[model samples]
Target: MITNFLLDHSALVPVAILLVALVCAVLGLLFADRRRILWALAGVSSLPVFALTLVPTVHTIDEILCTVQFSVPTLGAVELLANVALFLPPVCFAALASRRPVTMLAAGSVLSAVIETLQALVPAIGRACDTNDWLMNTIGAVLGALIAAGTAWLVDRRAQSGSSTGAISS
Candidate 1:
């Protein structure tokens, strides 16, 4: 039934839900006067995805640690890319919501560090805490924050230009 489907696509389920939630949150932010709530939702939405990323598929820790290990070359590159994607959206949302790039960057760093530490300490989670993963996640968050800042700047510039042009015409 539904359980069979979820079992088959466990990795995809949370990511899909997160993507859907992100779209809804963005749409809500567009119409809502109180954007902070939507921003908070955006921030909180990462939790389930994070948990899914750490979830142990097996009762044994061996597979978990091995799967999360840091490697170089083709597989490593792919894993690093996945980590970047995982952290990017949450950081972008945080930066956009708070309008503070530095804060978002710091928050993203701390969050990644904490997740890694927890994974290393918690045997039940059965996930490896690789420094490489932490580094990649932080990089992604910083990039997201930078992108958000740039977008805000562009928007403000456009708004200013529009106002000035209207004033000149008037």
Candidate 2:
């Protein structure tokens, strides 16, 4: 299955993700508006997230097992902020790039859930699943969506009022 392949070839997964992102960017570059480049970046901006969570960095485990019971998030400020930061870029970019920011929010939330679930279900990966991480990630996604929505509203208002960016006669 695809999951087995990704787990076995951890190193190649990043390469493949980057390659896809590159392809998306190139296609976006050819678009008339070229806003799709934001979409491409938004999706792949999770490189840090994938690198930190998916890659097995933890060492010397007491038992080679996965934690099924999801516990409360007890990580300190730094770790908590890092988790939130990880999802912010991708979701923000996705929102700015698309008219439907909700899709980006949903994608970010689902992405976090899937990552946490994988960590809990797979013991060999050496990652711990926590509800806290998911919560923070979802928060970041929501913030991104909200920011984009506010920006869109401002743009619409400006257009309706026939206001320009302080332009002068040519």
> Which model scores highest in TM-score?
1
Candidate 2 residues lying further than 4 Å off, grouped into runs, are 1-33, 58-76, 161-170
Candidate 1 versus truth, CA RMSD in Å, comes to 5.9
Give candidate 1's whole-model lDDT: 0.65
Tens-place lDDT per residue, model 2, 1-170, is: 64466556555554543454344334333331446667677657778779888887655334434434433433334455456656766776677678567998998999999998877776667777877788878876876666566655655666656655445322
Model-by-model lDDT, in order? Answer: 0.65, 0.65
Predictions: Cα RMSD each:
5.9, 10.1
**What would the TM-score be for candidate 1 when compared with the true structure?**
0.68
lDDT of 2: 0.65
